[model samples]
Target chain A: MADDIAGRGDPIKTLQLMWGRIEAPKRGPKSKLAVADLVRAAVRLADEEGIDAVSTRRVAEAVGISPMSFYTHIPDKAVLLDLMLDAVARPADGSEEAQAFRPEDWRANVAFVAREYRAFYLRHPWVLQVATHRPVLGPNTMRAYDYFLAAFDGLNLSEVEMDLSVTMVANYVHGAVRDVARARMVKELTGMSDDEWWHAIAPFLETVDFSPYPVASRIGPVVGELYGLGDPDRAFEFGLECLLDGLAVMVERKGGRR
Target chain B: MADDIAGRGDPIKTLQLMWGRIEAPKRGPKSKLAVADLVRAAVRLADEEGIDAVSTRRVAEAVGISPMSFYTHIPDKAVLLDLMLDAVARPADGSEEAQAFRPEDWRANVAFVAREYRAFYLRHPWVLQVATHRPVLGPNTMRAYDYFLAAFDGLNLSEVEMDLSVTMVANYVHGAVRDVARARMVKELTGMSDDEWWHAIAPFLETVDFSPYPVASRIGPVVGELYGLGDPDRAFEFGLECLLDGLAVMVERKGGRR
Candidate 1:
């Protein structure tokens, strides 16, 4: 699982495995544990017990296969993670039709995709642990990126701005959802409510000379009131609107949309 | 550090300790250790090792103090971490002047502060481990929020828009910087550069049908060329400009800036 990069086997070969571009192992016995079965088991393990609980041995055991057989399909845990990420990257119902981008309603299309993307992260917080430094772009990963790009099909954006807008929208959703998902995890782990925690710290906040922070003082509570202070949903929707609004301005700035 | 919500000591008292609203421990003998000294030691430990290495026992050992004495100043590792975060939250030179907001140059002020904020996260990635469910809002954190709000002092936004805009900008920066910082950490730990990884996988990517993913195929390599696909700094700057552009649109939509 902790194999060094060079020792982790050929990434290109791994990509072939992930994308089903290569045939199944002919050397192995015709076992019932197909690659999809293994990936499903791993995803379930990660969802139930968090990312740390997922190792090649544990996943193989869960699927009633030997570790050697698992390795015959997946060289290491890293590849297993990539497969698992790709498995969950699509809509939960496994319907490609639901994910089709609507060029006519681009704003709504972006919002819909962004919301679904946020839900994916919330469901599998462990995916964020895998640094995207070398993103393993499988079929689903490519589709996801393509779907995001399709939202700006006729917006007349330079390739650079189109890419930038997609990235900005994605980053905003990721950042907003990350905070919300993380907060939920913390609350569950600690068995504490936000209200209880804030009530405890309210007295100390009062002691501070907020006069110096005039804008934050006047608007902080109001902002806090607009949505529950730690509510990611409200923040996500609000941020998404601002991002889409900004993308529209960019389109306008680039000499009107086609 | 895994202290339960109620089991943890008074948050008000901890805030007082963080803000120096309380005095140094009178119960302990005259010692060289101040709270800041202990925090610095802990920060160094977290930096050298990861956040998991930071414990009251380890920090006390580094500072040559008994665990009991360590508890005298910090009730537990959670409070100690809050202090450590606050300590690094200030400008690296420990100068308040550097963090001062220039109300006249709102856009520049925001850009400057966002850059500084990104630098801080890169320096102390461990801060991300501490969930914001119960944000430890010390004087510096509040000041940071206040500084962000100050950028929109007369932007003619509703209180909600003002707050949402600030959050949008912040989340964009956070999302962008997270990718960059996490990539750097992965490279350091794995001894693998992204270029090396991509070069290794480029062959397999070519085998995939690009025709199906028109926009991604058209612009993906272009973006990959512009800044190395995972380069967070380039992405951060681009996203920041988009967010500010969006905020400006909101100001204009709301009847222009004051």
Candidate 2:
């Protein structure tokens, strides 16, 4: 992400790798490994050991290839990171999950879009840690961007409104994803569930007086026990619904097709 | 974070430290530094460096104290992390910023809450990197939580609805904060603005055919140029407006207090 953001490496080459315009020569090659093999391996390393674990050397070893050979498919760690994320960002078409995301009404489609992206992010939790400001202009990344943009199709949003709507929904989902990922990470790292962790800490908390914070004193446990770790799913639903309603109001105020 | 979640430390001690109930005895041979001094130093380290830069040993050096004495103020790294976040979570009550956040109508108040948090998160970018699922139960943390929950007061929401409302708002704001932070971090780390970075890569993007993504083709450059590395302030306003509208719809739907 740093390398890409810094304008290092060949942008054309990164785009080429992204669009699959260039590929390793198949004939008379020492190995027939595709560029995707490296990206997939890198993704696996990230899923297991975090994004920091993803390196050309590590991925090459995982793919049973040499460092020099790995570079034949992926340009650099930055380009490799770009490809890995685009692979995750690519719409999961033809999968069982994709089937469930079939669009209905505009509102249902909007909800589906949020749900799909949330699931997509969860599947590759480390991807959220990557740079989000400058979305990689890869083919798969473009396809994912199109998918989100089309969610509000025929909804009467102006050009700018359409773009901002997509951005806000994505921001909301990513926020939710971060919360869930935090919970999952804590559990994975500490080898304890939120339930057990809270239970373990309950003894100490029991001694603290809560007379001052009326709202927290009353609602804290109800929320804490129910949502020990943040409940992103529930929060997403609530937020998305409100967001959709808010959009409807704006559209109505603007009054139909412009 | 790992230690706190795993329930390894004395929560009472952490609470005491967080609430300012415990302080180094000042009458003896020890220096005049207080727990706030250590926390303030840690906050500074986290702001300049990342959160990982903060540790008992490092903070002790920053505060001109010994690690043993630092331990006297903080129990462990996890407790230190909790205290650090709680400090960030502490509202800028009398500061000029808080003066602007004076309560108004419910909708205005909701917007204020989101904006306040966005500003708060931006002030301490590293704080967002810490685990967020289980918020530290310190006085400042609870105080912040109370302030959030109170945004919807007298809106006729049930207890559960009121709770969910606050959760969704924080999620949305944090979402916005992440986008802004990503842009800021990229610029700070690379010594190049997103505009400069994009200009460097524009030549490669110019050759691509964006026809398939007509929505992206037309709107991409507009948003990309205007937003550069994600315009969270604009995105937050749009999202918050939609969220407020949506909440109004729900409130109207429920019809009255239970």
| Highest lDDT scorer | 2
Clashing residue pair totals per candidate (backbone < 3 A):
0, 0
| Stretch of 10 with least lDDT, candidate 2 chain A | A1-10
List residue ranges in candidate 1 displaced over 4 A: A1-17, A20-38, A52-61, A64-79, A94-100, A255-258, B1-17, B20-35, B48-61, B65-80, B94-105, B256-258
* TM-score, model 2 to reference: 0.83
lDDT tens digits, residues A85-165, model 1? 788776567554365665566678778878877887998876655543356688777878887888877777777777877
lDDT of 2 by residue, B108-204 (tens): 7778778888889888877666654355888777777777777777767766788888887888788777767767866776676767767877887
lDDT of each: 0.72, 0.73
| TM-score (chain B) of candidate 1 | 0.81
A53: Cα error in model 2, Å: 4.4
Query: Mind giving the per-residue lDDT tens digits that candidate 1 earns over B1-258?
Result: 211222256577678877888765578477677888899998997776656578788889999988778987778766777787788776567454456665555667768777877888898876655543367678777877887777777767778877877787788777777667666766775677788887878777777788878889888888788767645666788778777766666677787542
Once model 2 is optimally superposed onto the true structure by TM-score, how far is the C-alpha of residue B212 displaced, in angstroms?
3.2
